[model samples]
Target: MRSVNYARPTPALAIHDLRKSYGDLHALKGVTFGLNRGERLAFLGPNGAGKTTLIRCLAGLTSADHGEIFLAGQPFKSSEARQQIGFVPQEIALYADLTTRQNLEAFGRFHGLRRRVLRDRLAWALRWTGLEDRADDLVGAFSGGMQRRVNLACGVMHEPRILLLDEPTVGVDPQSRQRIFMMLDELSATGTSILLTTHHLDEAEERSDRIVILDQGMVVADGSLDELVEQSVGTQRLVRLRIDRPLSAPIRAGVAEHAASFGATGEEEISTRIDDVSDHLPGLIDLVRRRGYGIADVQVEAPSLHHVFLHLTGYELRD
Candidate 1:
């Protein structure tokens, strides 16, 4: 008799062969990925890249045409999986006339949290959002940032196992954005999985554990910043040097020999595009200095996430 092998426990979320369509349009084309427990994954892409469709399917608001999603080892279509997921949309959903405490209590009850559990969750939600002092005040009376915080607190009131956030930091002050991320960090520390979609590249690059880039319903790139940069942009770095005075024609020719390409930007500034600035910069600077010019300024710009995005997806604006 053959021995039986049980499957390993699934991660917080596993999406396989996700496909969705609208008439002639294929929104998601066999999308597949897995998110680890306590991981923060940022989903990014150009407009109309199926981000909304994917989120809808994950949140259980819309059924996928063909796919399978498992949450914490349970089929995503099951009630158990649905109960463990929390969603925070771009638009605020709290009742304006209700107080912060009232909103949380209503959400907690709707999630079937009862008695002491509801009370404890509500108190923690208020304290986590720094809304304990304003618990009795109407949500409409709060600032945009405060209201955003309330909106977040409501989604988290049930202590969900996984959270999906869509542009949670949109239209808020920097301080509020910081608080929102801090709150998310705390949740992640407690072992909650997070999936985020936002247009803020810097925020995604800074906060996410891993990033997945979708373009026209396909996974074009997936990895950390260093990994993506190495694959897409190579080891190149942009170096700009300005001198007190422009070099003579012969001296300019000498600088060009050491650079992949050198061009005059301003009166005394020259731009050098090179791979591994550390190797070429010293030589280039010495070459320029020997020609009787003082180095006025030096600027080194690295390839960034934005550059990688534009590289994979063109610079044309998407509606």
Candidate 2:
């Protein structure tokens, strides 16, 4: 029989059975996940969730005691891995005295690019950051948004296959934040896998291709927002109403099972779970009229990551 070769594409990055600790405290516990080529993953966790520990391990800044990290399907080696990973820490990392071009050149050389190649990368970085006009100016003189661009541009001068970002838009204005994501979108077009950690729930929900939540050194949830919502909290939304005055006992008694719960509660505002807004909202409004209860206000809270995070991780404040 003729042999047919069927080769599988390697993932951009993978962590398997990862474990790390600090004395009696466990920093990571059997953590496992994968980043497909060109995928954008939002890594989320509350304070002290060991997010920093994992990022350090992957960036070669610190070693993991037990887990194996794979880059392009091969075991990680410091020298080889350096070229495959790019890290942009949350804090700005740049020399205040150095010009934008100078900083780019220095960072590019650090990653082993030299001579003509380094010059070409510098040109690319300038364009990528939209700081071409300010290339000759010291980075310290630039505004927060401009410096943030340089911070981001420095990390990608070598164009690694994987990027790790910690709050990539932390200090920039809204316009700059939008521009930053635009730059990220361009990088994504080139097949770079990104893993970012941020407390901005809205950004994670909208921008990330997938979400991985960590709590107490373990993976609590991993999936799209809808998928995680369905798994952890179900799809029901809460519909709340504040009545101008309480419903009389006779009116309360007349409420059917559907609207009865709305009146049974002793509070001025009552809420109910709804599966569909279009089908359920009209009836609820009608019930308010039939009972002669004036609705002062109404609110609907959808099932989202905010709910999911609190659901799986609990409401207790994390120090």
Q: What is the Cα-based lDDT of residue 147 in candidate 1?
A: 94
lDDT of each: 0.84, 0.86
How many Å off is the CA of 234 in candidate 2? 1.5
Residue 199 of model 1, lDDT score: 94
In the range 52-164, model 2's lDDT, one tens digit per residue, is: 99998998998888989999899989778789999999888999899999999999999889999999999999999899999999999999999999999889989999999
Return the TM-score for candidate 2, rounded to 2 decimals. Answer: 0.91
lDDT of 1: 0.84
Highest lDDT model number: 2
Point out where model 1 deviates above 4 Å.
Answer: 1-9, 246-261, 264-267
| Distance from true location, Cα of 170 in model 2, Å | 1.7
lDDT of 2 at 92: 85
Error of 1 at 88 (Å): 0.3
